[model samples]
Target: MPPPHSLLQLIWLASPALPVGGFSYSEGIEAAVEWTGLDSEANAAEWLSDQLHLSFARGDLALAAQAITAWRAGDAQRIRTLNDWVLHTRESAEFLLQTEQMGRSFVEWLKLHHADTAEVFAGLPATYPVAFAFAASRTGASVHDGCLAFAFGWAENMVAAAVKAVPLGQSAGQRILARLANEIPAAVDRAMQLTDDERQAFAPLLAVLSARHETQYSRLFRS
Candidate 1:
């Protein structure tokens, strides 16, 4: 470990306000609300929490851990393979754009900090998950810690969206976040053992919702 408080450094690894442009996208929550009957703040929160466990948190974090392991081993080829898989598997055009935009933006900032590090790309060829993993691993965060932080960030983002979309009280949004804390550990456990071949998840519901959001009358977030 780098030091007693080295874990704090991981905070920088996945900062929501980083140049990665994360706030510009709502990770399909907007679509889920518009298409499904998940219109209320409470319903949106529930849907997002379930999604955090079943799909986004599980699939992305696993790939991130794998990328971190490969990066640590100095296996550039494996890292590239992980990147390629993300490129192929993130089927939605909007979703792919979100990941690639965030990944490239993250790489731009990361290279500023990790210059001279082997294979550090000026533009990340890896997906957002892998980029996040590499950044956290480089900063001495444990794989579990990294994954949880990643999930927490997205969870919080959904809460923000609920606050905007449903006229939910700020306190209610915080309560939703507190509720997610209880569920994250079980999801993290599943993410740790997730295999690349098992990356496909039944999240087509969100995809369909997102496609519909493009035509929805009004929305709080970009799909």
Candidate 2:
């Protein structure tokens, strides 16, 4: 169980403004738009909506929830194993690099705030889910909030990408965001039930697109 102060810590850790460089990447949405001719706002929205519902919400959030549970149980080895496995499993080199970069940044930021007690967890992969769990556990956040936050954060990035690639109006983006809020709770619930192994996702098409984006003469995202 997390102490009260730990909950506040978790909130801070998960804040969008934490400077993790997550905003720069669209998890391959950029490439999808460039290569697949998903150029229109409506086309981008539908594709993003499906991808969010089918892939990220169902997969990554589930893994992150499991990781949070493991972290709360003080299972350091499980945390490391999960993060490393996720790192290797990511098919795109750029996507893998993005996660690793953010993970390392999150851990480094946490280190400056934690005392000697958290030093061991510091060197772990610091994957987004692992970091989210570490923050939640340390801050006393419930499993529910951690999972929701993780899902919401991921969902928002997709929405952000939609806003950019779709070139949707700001109000249109906000509308999409509002519509998404209704889906998140259910997604979080589904995620809570998954085990680490079950969290695996093989998004080969998306991976190939992302890798291809690397050689695209003009690219905006790191992955």
Please name the candidate that would achieve the greatest TM-score relative to the true structure: 1
Candidate 2, residue 58: lDDT: 62
Q: Show model 1 residue runs off by greater than 4 Å.
A: 1-3, 117-119, 122-124
Measured by TM-score, how close is model 2 to the native structure? 0.87
lDDT per residue as tens, model 2, 1-223: 4566755665566466777777788788878877787776567666766666677766777777777778778887888887887787778888788878887777777777676536756466677667766766665678787776666676677778767764677887777777677778877787777766567667888889889978977766676
- Computed on alpha carbons, the lDDT of every model, listed in order, comes to 0.73, 0.72
Could you tell me every candidate's TM-score relative to the true structure? 0.89, 0.87
lDDT for model 2, please: 0.72
- Lowest lDDT sum, 10 consecutive residues, model 2, at 116-125
lDDT of 1 by residue, 98-193 (tens): 788888777777777787533666344756777777787776667777777777776776677766766578888888888887788778778778
How far residue 174's Cα lies from its native spot in candidate 2, in Å, is 1.0
What does candidate 1 score on TM? 0.89
